[model samples]
Target chain A: AQSVTQPDIHITVSEGASLELRCNYSYGATPYLFWYVQSPGQGLQLLLKYFSGDTLVQGIKGFEAEFKRSQSSFNLRKPSVHWSDAAEYFCADYDSWGKLQFGAGTQVVVTP
Target chain B: SAVISQKPSRDICQRGTSLTIQCQVDSQVTMMFWYRQQPGQSLTLIATANQGSEATYESGFVIDKFPISRPNLTFSTLTVSNMSPEDSSIYLCSVERQGRDGYTFGSGTRLTVV
Candidate 1:
């Protein structure tokens, strides 16, 4: 069985500040990882995904994540965040038949 | 990528009542999934809605409680039978696109069982 862990429950960052959300996973084989953002009263939107490819994967809204196999981590990063970026971010590990095992999520609050 | 449109975006039902959430996809997909998310939490896979077959549910979830229907490749419905306060959560529908690209999710149906 595979699982994901997000260390941060909530994080507050000022506008234009760099942000990083930590995510670690426990999987036996090469795992497929993904980041998704969810706003209040809304469904989730995929930010990015990592399969077998470059270590650094770029996503929409200027977000990026690096897959570090040794660290078993795929941390999400953004150079500058806007208030609109404030939401709950989740990291998911793909299961057989492409099911997802999601983390508890990290709530991001952008302060002006 | 596939686009999902889920209906009954939100509803409040009495205990023991049932609510069926519908999901329609723009394109045919091989896998359709249902998930549950409690307030301020992550998503837990409820089941895989396979076309013309019985849905495969995850651990801690049973078919009797969360009955799913996939009449075709692009449409599915999840019914929360015998609802309870514990069943109050956001139910989301998703479809796998291109196997490895990513899963596209619907806006979610928020169910509050009082």
Candidate 2:
């Protein structure tokens, strides 16, 4: 079975600082990768996705992720962090059956 | 993108009771997925509801525990049966976007079993 792993359980970043969230998957081939954000008391929102073509994918809310097949990783990065960005981030992979497998998630805390 | 309306945004229930969550999609879809999110945890798929057929349950989930109904293409329901405090979690419904490889999810139903 395919699985997603998010090594970081929590990350604290100062406002306006750079942020990065790591995600790795265990699959023989490159699966459909995705990044989602969940605000406190909210549902999951699609940040971006990568199926094929460009390695760099841009998503809503000024978020971007890089798909590196060699490392089996799709890490999300933001140039600058905002207080609103403080939330839970989940990395997932879609299977052939179109079901999604999500990582444990990383809680991001933005500080002043 | 598709819009989903999920009812009973939240509810507090006593143990051994049951609560049903409904999800209605704006457009017709082939599959509607049900998921559970424990507090401070990631989402776990419960089952896949297909129109006019029995829902496919994931491992560790049974039809008796999460009986689903997909009477049509645009609507489906998931009932959390014999609820316990362990069943206290957010239940969400999702549908893959038509003509795309994306998915749209409902706002989720927050359930608290005491």
* Best candidate according to TM-score: 2
* lDDT value, residue A62 of candidate 1: 100
TM-scores for all candidates: the values are 0.96, 0.97
lDDT of 1 by residue, B32-101 (tens): 9999998767898899988878999988999999999999999999999999999999999998768676
Q: After superposition, how far is residue B23 of candidate 2 from its true place, in Å?
A: 0.4
lDDT score of residue B50 within candidate 2: 97
Considering just the first chain, candidate 1 attains a TM-score of: 0.96
What lDDT tens digits, residue by residue, belong to model 1 across residues A26-100?
A: 964879899999988888899999987799999999999999999999999999999999999999887665567
What's model 2's overall lDDT? 0.92
Q: What is the per-candidate TM-score for chain B?
A: 0.97, 0.97
Pairs with steric clashes in candidate 1: none
